[model samples]
Target chain A: MRPGHEEIKDKLPEYISTGNIPDDVKEHLRSCDKCSQEAFLLQELNKVQVPEPGGLFFETLPQKVRASVRQKKKGFLFRFVPVFTLIALVVVTGYIYHTITPPLTEEELFTDPFAIQVFDLSGLSEDDIPPISVDIADDEIYLTEETSLYREFASLSSEEMEDLYEALEIKNRNGGVL
Target chain B: MDVKQTRYAEDLRLIEKYLGGDEYAVEELVMKYQRKVYSLAYRMTGDIEDSKDVTQKTFLQVFANIRGFRKKSSFYTWLYRIAMNTCLNHLKKKGNDTLELNESIAGSNGNALPALIKEERSSFIRGSLKKLPDRQKTAVTLRAYEELSLKETAEVMKCSEGAVKAHYHNGMKRLKEILSASADSPGRKGEGI
Candidate 1:
């Protein structure tokens, strides 16, 4: 109720605990009803007793706690099961995407000139191309110089080479056009 | 080591054992502090059932977050902190429920008349406590009910010692007023004297 009453009340518990109330606080408590009541209430609040649960409560509390903890752990795992499954599905899908054989793009086909390229035969007639048969017994037709195909072409006369080059140019043009 | 240091050591040992997968360590830890936690909860909730529930929830939380117990404060202080928070939340959930005099006085061990009288007084005290603001109730609960030192109360409360003093002083003032009002008002059940 006074300017210093709050300070005294704050110190009251400490004073009571140590059994060393300062003379000023003691004097104040003697005169101040508010502070006296506060002190008495604090003492009573501390002294008020609560009933203890029976021995069975204490005996069974741990088991109850343990059961609850175990239930919680199970709940945690259950809660995350779907998340783990989702992650696994994503990873498996990624691996499958990378592992599957992919269709060759035109760029890939063009990058390697010698690589096999699929032709659209739907527009071409069989009679549009001529085929010749080779005699397996012709020894002179064999590749005598195995090192280079160019060496065999080098042996051709200028006129023959000119005709062969023209034939190759025509084949390339037809392949692209078709 | 002093007695407190020894307690800290034992608590740490049990915590370590619990964390290390010793199942019985949990039982040991629970047994050690259940009474104190229940006592604090009983004061805050003023009912035996709510007290039991709060005490169990406190331990459940403590064990669940045991890995986060940084040992910055003693295990006892940390336990009180969890118990206090649980009590506050439980009280909020209860939301202005008044204490039943008969239920509040159930735990007496002796002569009926004196015990009933004491319980009546206690019931009035708990009713008065419920009227306090959360912080003031907490301050009084820690200082008066749990018997924590101001510093320990501050640690459990996560506040400065000055703040605890302020809350506690205000709480005591309010309690005196409430008790006085109860005494004067004949409609009020207990004298709280």
Candidate 2:
């Protein structure tokens, strides 16, 4: 047996159809009845004609297929319309809500936690405001002590007056004796 | 790969489109293979209307089962396999269940006639071919009549390349025997294969 006969026999059908036999396969096919017989039959099969249909027989197939698909989609679209409408309604409602709603005021946005709203004083004149009172006597705080302290202490309580009288008496006595 | 080879890639792209719900892709798919499918059918069934029927069945199968097609082979290969099955079913339904040979005589290579005689010869060959085993007939029809490559024939036949070749070999051998036996004499009732 030739070294390549097995391969050739294995590939004989392809070799016969394509006429591109390997050299070893070719050598083997000459002596091999089985392989040669295959080659001959394959060759004859080549003579069979591929028949062509007359006119435009196949031209309408695309339309037919398209029509069928269209029918299916139309059925689907009936189901599709309600879902599509629902989605559209939701989206439109969301957009309206975002557009029509009022915005937050600056005060409401940036309010201070420690601050309170008070009446304005920038519009008031001095005469429109009351004076602030000081608890000190005028002579002491404004008169430079030239005024008599005895007159100011005349309304003092008994103990304080007594102490003031004593201090005054001591001062007078020390002045006269000295 | 040759010019015809590039069409496979294009077919894959269209199939992707078809799967993606482009109706146009369906139309395009039908447009691409309709004629070839019809022609293969016409040749296989030997009737124009029957060819149309099988072609319709073939594409219908493509439409229905396209989602399940794994892209393991090119779309045409799978389509033709479906076409081949449909054709075989048709032939089977028509009860051409065996190779009942009808002998047809011929003029040898030197004396073969032209025109009308050629048509006669072609018809005779087709007629005689029906007598082959179903598998051999399918292999030859795909490989020879359709001129599909062995690989494509294997895909269409849903068999290995080796198996396809074996079917082709047996078919070719049987075809030769039948043709030769018929060619032994013209205008005579031939023996059954």
Report the lDDT tens digits of candidate 1 across residue range B107-127: 332222222334356667777
| Model 1 lDDT, residue A102, Cα | 76
Query: What value does the lDDT take at residue A13 in candidate 1?
Result: 71
Error of 2 at A55 (Å): 4.2
Question: How accurate locally is residue A64 in candidate 1, as Cα lDDT from 0 to 100?
Answer: 92
Distance from true location, Cα of A62 in model 2, Å:
2.2
| Cα-based TM-score, every candidate | 0.62, 0.57
The true-versus-predicted C-alpha distance at residue B126 of model 1, in Å, is 1.7
* Cα-based lDDT for every prediction: 0.78, 0.71
- For model 1, the superposed segments whose C-alpha errors exceed 4 Å read A1-37, A74-178, B97-120, B189-193
Q: Which TM-score values does chain B get in all models?
A: 0.83, 0.82
Q: Is the docking of candidate 1 incorrect, acceptable, medium or high quality?
A: acceptable
